[model samples]
Target: MVSVHVTTEVFPFDQSVDLCPDNDALNFTTIFLITFGSGPTLFSNKTPADFNFTTSHSQSFTFDVNDGMFAFVNEVPDLNNGWHGNASDYTTNDTDGYMFLVNMQGIDPQIFNYKIDDLHIGRLYEFSAYVANVVRKEKCLNKPNIRFEVRAINESGNVIAKKGTGDVPACYNMSWSKYDISFETTHSSVVLLMLSNVAEGSGNDLAIDDIELRVYSTNDLDDTSTTASSIFDCKNNDEDYCECSNDFIGLSCKIQSDDVCSKHDNNTYESLFFITFGSGSDRFYSKTASDFNFKTDLKKESWSNFKPGAYAFVNSVPSSLTVLWHDAAKDHTTNDTDGYMYLAGVGNVNDMIFNYNITNLCVGVDYEYSAYLTNVMRDIRWVSVTEPNIRFEVRAVHKKGDLIAQKSTGDIPVYQHMTWSKHGLSFVATSSSVVLLMISNVGGHPGNDLAIDDIQLRVSSANQTGFCYPG
Candidate 1:
């Protein structure tokens, strides 16, 4: 007989076990109950202690007899001896000073059913246990292969959710490892935690301990603060809060921000406009309202000739330029479908420059300007520029020609293949009216011809605290 101790008022037990002369030396060969703060609790002191395990509770088991299939004991088998593999072969911390051992030949799969009640509807719960194969030898033919499963059952005995550990071999030399199974309950009902053997021979055996079931609320698993807003709110510091969108980081959402410009083109902002050869035809933008277009022309004459005030020129030299539109037969990549701006510079004359007069920008707000650039390749007859390096620059200027912010893609290799690359920079706007966006090829090399597309300028809304860059 085993003696039981009741310590907490919350847990009450009615059954009693006769005390053994030496409680520590008592080795029971049948299922029994041992009392402790954290170890497995008893369903009842009766013959079969199954079907009473509940949430947030644990139960411990041990082998009943040496040759018997299932048994419960207070200690692990001795080290490296027939039943015991090594001195250290045991459960984790041996909290209850007990463990359940399963003999492979007799009871290949030992099932334990738990009755769960008072569970909240639509709640998630985690069931886990520490399991290990008691075998220590690497080449031992009877290595214990075990698995743990958790299944939820409704009042009608219908299974709602089931999860399991397929196969966990005792390859860790008797060391204990945890197995976890989680399920979201649809209806308040019972849950079953089962442990079974995958190996069938006699030498295959396993030990299990520290079984636990825990319930968690949805709010506990959500990382985002409910008090924060989805979009960044830079103004109301007291009442306004922010939970930066994915890819955006920083406090106040003032740092690394989302790409305002994707692979698309649009006049979403009234101040936004594109520089093209004609009023509307051959626009240096995509034909698709929100898609990028990367089309080129053999000669600048194919479109309207460059006119002063319509386009920005760097060297004051007239050169042929065109907007490339998407043509399935010509474009190498489908990434830029609408079209892109192209410059066919004359040798020794660097004259490509783009200027836009933007209005109504928020003063003192940080903004990011970005665009995609690549070397255009049309046909074998088209001359390929092998400058090896190309430089692109962007600057924000006032109507008075005062430079507000300036950034550049220092130097990029002009590969022979057609591959578009993104370049961008962040800046703080100083004024709202007449903000000028200057896109230029600062390289002095005349043949620095390239294609530019998907230009965008938007306010940066990523958190900008302590060394964090704008997203």
Candidate 2:
């Protein structure tokens, strides 16, 4: 048995080395060099073949080429302006004679396997190879794509570290290129290197040559002090303690910055008028009256209503026969917290209308008005008689009743029962003073009933630009 000391060295096999006994035996573990090509003494073998060798460390390495999948060619085939025509295409020494030409797809695909012993744990190793795509002028069908993978496995057969050049696409009429991949090993025992053609069946063809691997120690890495200084370096104009780049915010530069709405935050928004219709004075529904007459005065519980300067109305009346306003926990589930109640009614001859007037809004500024709605099947028998469609519309009007903008939640098929859905319209205020938000049911069917809650009108920021009347 021969003992070989494996040290960090570069290997370029320019001299004669072969697996055959007639030629000099390649003691890979000792010589640290190997090449796949014929010398002046041997005739070039064009057929696909396998070269197998054993390392001094007793690890087996096999370079297998499938029958019709690959060939040892001396020059790139004349096509596509001779993409890889240069003799020194992908070789470092520039004295290239033979290279592995792979036809990405065939009855059997091209593959190579090599086992390495005693890799340093936690150390980073870089594997690189020169490769070129053989371009064909005819149709240019299936182009070649290749991958070089390295896996560090333990005795238990579990992969501890894995890395690869995922896929390299064919470079048409381009020079041979070098690709490198780096990985840190978790296990120290062995490393398996595999080179494979990953392109799909047929046309994709490429050539590969001069594969190399190098190990890097931790001390060889970039200076850590430079990285630390850049992270903590504060700029004079920045409000945060650390001047973080790449959209990183916060004192420690830990938070990723997001698109901020000028007039609104994640939890709250700038609202001219808002109502949740929850408990207490905020409740917008009444049991005694058939409709809310905001023309007289503002109701104690209502936020916006019909008045001398502004007007609002709702054709809603409490009924004992149907399920109306109740805590979300009582019979329905709402998006809001406890005590969130809702108002509901069915479409009839006089459509169920909910309208309010908002005043003192900023002109030319966009605002979003939204409300939650849920299908309520108070009477299941009505569902069979009426059309299965429900439509709702919301419009923004000026104080003098001129239309600003209008949007509709188009015919939504009744599927989810009692599930709260949100419908909203964004509009820009044409007048700075008063705006009327009117929500009404346009689908006038007997059973088209829906619950409405959490009406809100807020200033729109960010990409919340409202849509205007399309000409």
Candidate 3:
């Protein structure tokens, strides 16, 4: 630390001293003393209380500071033109007036009789400066801005720390800019600092004040975390209520028991078959459970061994417009048709089998029916008729039992081999009603027995609904 005191018989002007430090040699803990005045500046080997002066008195003492820290004094002119300065050794003869008075504050003001020594490195240091200006002679430059800077260097005289050329602003009241200076301990080696006016040109006078320096080490702080981790769980038995959790890698599934059904992700099952019965003791049989073939006619005995008034009726419920099938007759069961519809020779050589009914149907839907005869029993003689002659013809009547459509097969001689015949008729119903299919042989011999099989009823869609199978 450096200390000083001042007393003058008369105040002269203003004065200051500078002390530069070695930042490398000092580990920590350093101090400096600084003083200011509007009059003469004193740096004698005297205490401040022992100093004497008249108009105004001041003293500034310089002390060597560490490279990380240094001490210095600065002053700015107070006027745009006039003179200002500090006096050191005053003469009783009033001859040697005073130190160089700073002419003006702006536009390249100079530092007169100022010198620095002793600087250290790698230590935290404080620095400050002051300025006073007299503008009685010339106009100050435009926009007078000023700044201070510091640097640290090694014993090799290499500079380690230096402030950039940016200027620090000064107030008219002579405010000081105080800050710490530290040298980066690595490469170069030297420590120094400076103060200067920025650009120039200003109306009012300016000054610097209360320059100081201190040195120490910097303190430490604390630390924290970066990202967040979280999880979600869903546990209700609703297919639509569960969420796709992070554990499954964002893939969703209906959880049956902690795991999902492996086949399809979110789909379940629906049943396949349904039936509604109306009339007749009809039985359905399939070689397999998945088989769709249905035998349409009632089981019967022989066709040639005619029996009177023996007939059977099949019923269907009409839900929509569809194609359906019915058996008019079946003669493969036994040797006797004890009670049956007769087939007789006619003038048209037509034999007719009457009354086939699908008694149950939806009220307004139309239906088409077809009879397929797979095996026909025959005699040896040809039918006494023209080509395409028929032994029987099947016709359908609407729910009111009125005839709507008819179909018949071409005749085959008794000596001809047997073949299956597919006979079909189409009709539309005015109301939901049951219709009877009647078979008549119009131009051929009767007594040919037939066996029928495989019947179906199907409803089809003309267009599609918007929903699709989720799979």
Candidate 4:
């Protein structure tokens, strides 16, 4: 077993076998899980998509003309002499197994990387993998050293945690050695897991298999400052099935916390106005509301000013201005189909980008107007003109009638990457009807390019009733 020194309390799993090649080494390398801290259904048996190595997305050693990086074999293959030929996989028992015949050569040290999403905040996770140093002890040039790094994907690649497998000694009769590490997650929901070969020179080759990662039990979370056992309140101390605390409502108390995860709860709110548009269609926006923009795309119109509803679904944005512009990132929706975003270059007037009128709302009830916007342009200097300024507004009757409530996203500064920010406002429905509008706060300038998405007007879940549109 690899001894890991993390901040959290980690109980060690002993592998008492000596590093020297010996008989009965097969059993020492293959215990997949100890099943200790977590319940019976502790680890997720299947491989996570983020960390998995597949044929199409091969993330491994540099492709050698002789050995060609890696291959799927039952055991260590014979390259030259039979030093590593004795290594056999003990985890997968089948004709086609999990063992990887890896060859590390050339300059690139990175083995592979994976993406993780929707991790529970402050929850403990155990990551483990099996590997066998392929080099013979006497002829070992460089002992295989592996490094694991976790970086937040959305936070402009900020590192959260890291660990290293100390120089793996040569051979368990050329058998496998297990490596494990435990980490607690922070607020970052999306992360990248990268495995890199720390050692340079030859004899750094290894056979790796049975890579696994899953959530395990923790006495407490960093954020909540309370034990998961107490928050879950499992019946009869059954941790698997339990009752959630406060606003948490999910199986095993593993849903998103922070009270507002259920803001769009299917039973709580009815989508009164879901902002959607057509393929540069001028008829659609004006058809819904006469006061909306007469046109969608502004490429044909003047840059001095823009009309209300003069918005277009600007889903695609070139990552760089040079050769890779064709491979721009699509809209923010995570579906199999292509989704579009409201892309706009706000002109001098800080134009009224959108307007929608809905009728017969339940008076005295609550409603929320929300939209996500991101600045598509960047600036080397901190010029405020390059940033995007968006406003979400709610009003009674017509577009310019009595204002109900409003909120403006001051100046959305340029981030290292395209990071979307959500802006919203809540109001009590004084009248039976209201108009929702999206206005630009910044006039035409150097950097007012914006991408907007997921615009919605929803009634409070608790106040949502069928009578909201009752005849």
Candidate 5:
């Protein structure tokens, strides 16, 4: 070894210059490792039906068939100690189909694995599914959580992308909620998706259904058709750096922005008046004046031609009453057979269908109010029937003449399939309270029938006055 020389002499260079400047040219980078392509085909569920994949990391699984049960989609889960929800698989709502149950105890937690072959290099994909906790208790002791991993199979197998599903809390009564994770592929045309358990204790029991792999972005970080070994440093803490539009967030920028008040974000929606009508195991529960906040009264009859301001809380639409109407067995929100909806039989024009005064409003704050409504008149009608049109309005509760905002569901036409469309508007509250109104713009006996559900008012977290919208 040569002797080291500690030179005390000053270098013959300018002292004000930066000696150890950040040389970005020679910095260790991995952004160029993947060649991002433009115009990738957006797709869903690349794997076979219900994740039936032949290839996996290992061929062994400890799924106990004894604890695994099967139940029909539209029936109650009473046979399996009510482990699953009353309404099972979200996608296949067939009454004859069954959902396969899973057991908690197993040797290895890595129960599911699927290999995705057709992938555009440097493209982003998101895997999502509906998960439910079956513990039936307040605190989750053995709740099932999932860990997702995206592995590049055809390359060096160096990619290790992962995401975790935190403890899926119980809703006491059976409930189904969705969870998702995003990942980008690099260099490899084939990626192996591995789903494993990452729970702490035993009883990792869960009900899973409707697995899908959808494209979040066509390219990686807006770079198309250019890749190097180690070009620019374009990541921070293993997350891809993206210039996301304001409505999107997260590393991959795949998640839509939301708040505690919104349900479209798949988070627990908190609203001032959370009107679900009523809920039960698998029964249609009736309501009183308190349920509607003492605004309107229910009709003695649920059929057509009752009167103005008369309503019925029904779960299933009896098609025998109106042959031209659509028969919907499930509610719009819960998709449960026993979930109730407000079936309105309009009598006169401009009649108030439902009205309630929402109190304790935050001044100068934005809020979104909406109601799900479906026109009962079938699209295949022989006669020229007038479609139902409802006007939603919000007025200052103290000052009745001061109108805050108004919007109308202009001509709700019936589709071949039963569909519920949301009708409402966003407003900035100028007063402490507002009278929320739902009125029929045009009404008659045979043409103005409609069903309503999930009326709510929540804080508006997204605004179009910013960079997010007009993107």
Candidate 6:
């Protein structure tokens, strides 16, 4: 029999044996309960009485074998080897059917024995061993050594768990050896046991005694008693107060102590207004409400934010304004600045410069003539003089025709708006009398290739809208 070391007050196991106490004041083999001052107390069996102490009370207890007796001894002469059972039958092959053997030839007799089958799963077993060298050996003499091994095996003969050490020094004469083996089972199985010392030839003579094993079950472990806010109260696997998070594929779980990991656009008006033309690139600018000149292809136009109702004037030029006259005998090359303007390539048919004539001006009045031009690639020729060096001169034939206004060029580039003043002059409308605003090639050629964006001949302020021009 092997005994585990326990304090008279309370202490953990000191050997490799199952403990089964009979009172409530004691403990089971595999569990531990902690108390102040003393570190931890272990038990192999439950005690039947409560531990009623008043700091001065003394209680004493004793432990003895509860069930079967396992013995390892040699009855001389025939030499036994290990732990032996009582019953045997040679007809069935069994390890327990014969007596254990110990060879005592040329060396002293030796006995290495232990017991550990009583511990259950999730139990902590503490153990220690003692050995006596009955015949000390020095140089070809007898010396005894002991080894211990605990293997948890299932019913199918599989060794599922094992932990042990095999080197224990021997003691002279009647001596004691001690060791503690702690084991916990993760599966349900019956344990197989072995105790020996490097089983080989000669030099073996010792007796092993007082082997101890104590068990600690799962219920014996303690829980943290502090509050949640205390750092000491946190467990290793708890995630609420994580210290670090695992990182995988741009996603991660934060290990923050008390926080959640979170994706972090700013919207402004300056980012909205973008210039989309030119190259495929974009440029941003403040969207201001004002007039601007828009250009496309080879043509240019003046546009403004002001909208028009009914009709609008491009300068003093009216929308769809026209001039009309028909004469088969007249040369009609005279330049007229009465209520109309001219554009290049108008009447240069087959080299005969046929000028357009505005025929029926109200007699004896003033009127204003204006011209507008866009994308003027070359200098255009114009007859600005009222009197013709050819056949006619521009005079106010009506009171509205007297206001012949003219300007060389308007303030807007690619946009021309000139008015001819006819306020002080007047003339009569004969049958062949015609008005002209000639558009011949200036600086020596024809086909000036200029666009007349919007031209008009309206009474002053007839259908005027806001004009788009530079100040």
lDDT of each: 0.37, 0.39, 0.27, 0.47, 0.48, 0.24
Per-residue alpha-carbon lDDT of candidate 3 for residues 1-471, written as tens digits (9 for 90 to 100): 112112123232222221223223233343332343323332223433321111111232433211121111222222222323221211223332222122123222332111233433333344433333322212222212222333223344333222211122212222222222233223222223433332223322333333334444542111000000111232223324312231111011222322221211221321111112122233222122112222222222233332322222222111121111113333221233321211212223223333333433433332334333432333221221121222221123443343333333322222233333444332333333344333423222233233332222221111212112333
Residue pairs in collision within model 2: 142-204, 143-204, 144-204, 294-306, 306-311, 306-312, 307-310
Worst 10 residues of 1 by lDDT: 223-232
Q: What would the TM-score be for candidate 1 when compared with the true structure?
A: 0.33
Residues 47-130 of candidate 2 have per-residue lDDT tens digits of 322333221111111223232355555566453353444433344442445565655553113244445666676665554455
**Tens digit of lDDT per residue, candidate 4, span 328-427?**
5555554524456666766733466666677888777656667667766653322223345555556788555766654455456555467776666556
- Order the numbered candidates by TM-score, best leading: 5, 4, 2, 1, 6, 3
lDDT of 5 by residue, 1-471 (tens): 111121111112222321122322122111111001111221111222223333222211222123322211222344344354354443332333333244444322443555545555655555545566655533323455454456656545543344445344444454555554445556444443434332223445565554445453333332111110101111134442321222111112223233422334232434556676775543234565456683643353545544445677777665766677777545687755477777777766666777888666766666667778887767652334445666677789874447675545545665667787666656667777678887765544456788888888766444322111121
Q: Which regions of candidate 3 fall more than 4 Å away from where they truly are?
A: 1-30, 36-120, 130-141, 151-157, 164-191, 195-206, 219-471
lDDT of the structure predicted as candidate 1: 0.37
Which tens-of-lDDT digit does each residue in 1-471 have in candidate 1?
111121111222112321122222123221222221223432112222432342221322432433335444444545345544322323334444445554555222444556556566655555555556555333333344333333346444544433233223323234455554444555555655463322235455666655545454342332111011111122223432222222112122233333332233323323133332212223342232122222221223323653221221121122244222112212222344332343343222123343455655665655555556554433221222222122222334544554453333322333334566765444555656534333332222323445554455555443321122224
Query: Cα lDDT for residue 43, model 6?
Result: 18
Give the winner by lDDT: 5
Q: After superposing candidate 6, which stretches have Cα over 4 Å from the reference? A: 1-119, 127-129, 137-146, 155-166, 171-174, 211-213, 217-471
lDDT of 4: 0.47
TM-score of 3: 0.24
lDDT of 3: 0.27
Badly placed stretches (over 4 Å) of model 4 are 1-268, 276-311, 318-327, 382-384, 398-400, 466-471
Winning candidate number (TM-score): 5
Per-residue lDDT of 1-471 in model 6, one digit per residue for the tens? 112222222344433422222212125452221111211121112221211111111111222111111123221111222211121211122232211122223211123222224345555443333333333211222233322334444554433222222222221212223333333444443332333322223434443333333443333432101000001121223333211121000001122111111100111101111111111111111222121121111111222321111111121232222111111111111231121122222222111112223544433222222223332221111211011000112323344443131111101111123222111111222222234332211111122223232222222122222122233
Better of 1 and 4 by TM-score: 4
